[model samples]
Target: MYDIRKLVQEIDKEHYLNELEAKSKKSKKDIQQKMDKINKQIEVLKTRKKKFINMLADEKIKHDEYLEMVEDNNNELAQLVEKKNEMLSMLESEQVIDNIDKLKQELLQFLNFNELTPAILHHPINRIDVKEGGTRVINYRFAAPTFE
Candidate 1:
């Protein structure tokens, strides 16, 4: 008889790896898009600041109002810069990659076990549905495998 535990573990690991790859790609892309948006906003604020300076030099606006505008723009620019730096730091860190690698290694170790313990099953499986004629459907905790 086939070892059901081994079969389930194999299936779950394959599904998990695939899901992780897709999710990581999406997350990186999202972060990159946000960074781009922040950069654009920074550029816009810088342009506005320059225009304010030109208006002040030409004496088109009162000095006090120009100073107030410059202060507001500086505050907003500082916040955006801080946010961009944080995002860049996150991109530079290997934490996400390391965590995924660690999980993969742990799952690989499971291959050494001959039988699935309750802990192993519970970690990956959400529920099991039994159908007529002894067929069973497993719902994984993460996501179901896409056969296609």
Candidate 2:
């Protein structure tokens, strides 16, 4: 059965996370920081957005003022939201995705390790080389043979 792909997947998933935690504190720290930052930015944008809506409902506001305020708030919110998404995408890379898949396969290989651990014995291409100079190829059974 095919297994190399599975082995890589398992290593990436079950092993890679733990390994990453040990290997790169900065990456982990950066992720936590980004998450907190994104959340705070989102709240701020929501509040600003709500205020813009409230302004529209105010009876005293002129049409030009309403449009200008709405446009400004929209621009700010869009910028903040875009920054959050960019950070998230940066943190999530193709390597990590591939590793997760590889880890799954490795886990499966580990579970059925007894079979994988066993060595395979195949007959050698060259059976024996004589010192003076005859070259012989191996035949699994002794009874076989014609000289090439």
Candidate 3:
């Protein structure tokens, strides 16, 4: 069975890429606010794991109880790490690359270089093609740009 939620989320990838660009232009405080929220979640996970370890260190706790605490904390930490990695990879994938390429093309259009011919800009000296007597001759008399 096809899951509709997964399909919707796939469509949202483009929206998320745009959000990344907007965030880049946003205020530093706004950016840090969202980043701090993520850091808080990570800190909470670490603190919970620390408590699990501390609880297990008590001499009164039974061996099975200690093992259970350690196992639960380890599982939670593993899940968090996996989720973070998945998000990171999604942000780094080919869809984002294509989105960035499109954005660059748009920006280059604004730069007025999008329509320039490569042949005119590529050579230091402009050489007019000459074909005489079925032979080609190189002309180096063309004036090129100079910097003082």
Candidate 4:
């Protein structure tokens, strides 16, 4: 459990982050495909219910049979909708890897300075110009960090 190799992909944080993003994208695609399939199934059930109604109107099927078939169709639709809800929940809960570059920069800052302070914020700046509309202009020092 304490093994770093087990926790990350090949001991490279950038590579690990990229791999996570790729896996997340693939999982989203798979869930989207499954939801598409469920949507198709729901459409078919709806079409079947319409046909059931048409059969009753045409006197080809009895009222009782039409009701039974419609009930069964609705039940199947409900089940599929439940499945779709589950997939949606999974999609919402799925971990997405975004802003990897920003993450890497933060991680590097953490590695360089374990604790954050006002001094750290002011270290690589010439001056900060505050503007009127919730905007600020930042001036950088000649020795400002380039993150190279």
Candidate 5:
């Protein structure tokens, strides 16, 4: 049998999770915006390339001029597509920092909880210290592990 008490000895706050969420939201937003911009540029380039074809068919421009414009459009499209791919890769990498969810899922495997409700448990109290002037310090057994 799985011991939930040992599995969940302490509830720790995911400090980096919050910070990463904020950063990733902004990063993802920024990357999405850039991708959208690239898509629009690609569409514009396609439209321009089509216009060049129409112009060539209509004999409105010389063959050399039309070919040059089409070549330029292709070059710009290639560059934009490359940049877009880089942005997509960055977005994928940004999602790699998901340890908090992994930890949550692991804990959830042993416990079923939807929300926090009041509970009375004395096992969590490790000890109570009485000092001078009747001052008391209550030490809890379940606490976030401290790091040096």
Candidate 6:
């Protein structure tokens, strides 16, 4: 059996840290972009809602129609708000980004003992596939590095 821990031990800490930080930054930017888009959509809906209210007040739209439009707008707004909150919560989470040193240490310890503990294995190895001709394919939990 291949000692999977050796792979972790061989990683260059600085390179791994750089890759992790880059990934984190990209993820944060993507989430922020989505949130900004949602905010813009919400603003547009609010404007439409305001217009509907004005129309109703001026006796241009019937009461039932106004109520239905308002209800629809409220439901849509609620959904967008919920999605925005979820994105915000994700952006606020720093657990993965803050634990690089700890993770490195743990990986080193696991490698030193050459033990395949469930926690250690599951933390880094996503899966292993056995192929024909005794070939085994390994997949990592994080983005795999490309060797030059």
TM-score of each predicted structure versus truth:
0.59, 0.45, 0.39, 0.62, 0.59, 0.62
Error at 37, model 6, angstroms:
0.9
lDDT of 2 by residue, 36-96 (tens): 8878977886787677668778855777887888788778778877887776776774244
Which candidate number maximizes lDDT? 6
Q: Choose 3 or 5, whichever is better by lDDT.
A: 5
lDDT digits (tens) for residues 24-143 of candidate 3: 445334544554565667778788767766776766577788778778767876776666666555444424333554544433343344455664344322354667776744443221
Per-candidate local distance difference test: 0.72, 0.55, 0.51, 0.70, 0.70, 0.77
Q: Which residue segments of model 6 deviate by more than 4 Å?
A: 1-12, 105-148
lDDT of 5 at 84: 94
lDDT of 6 by residue, 12-106 (tens): 46676677678778878999999999999999999999999999999999999999999999999999999999999988873456665665666
lDDT for position 94 in model 5: 68
Per-model root-mean-square deviation over C-alphas? 7.5, 16.2, 17.1, 12.3, 13.8, 5.2
* Candidate 1 to truth, TM: 0.59
Native RMSD of candidate 3 (Å): 17.1
Better of 2 and 5 by TM-score: 5
Error of 3 at 71 (Å): 0.7
lDDT of 5 by residue, 70-96 (tens): 889989999999999999899886663
Steric clash pairs (candidate 4): none
How far in Å is the alpha carbon of 83 misplaced in model 6? 1.1
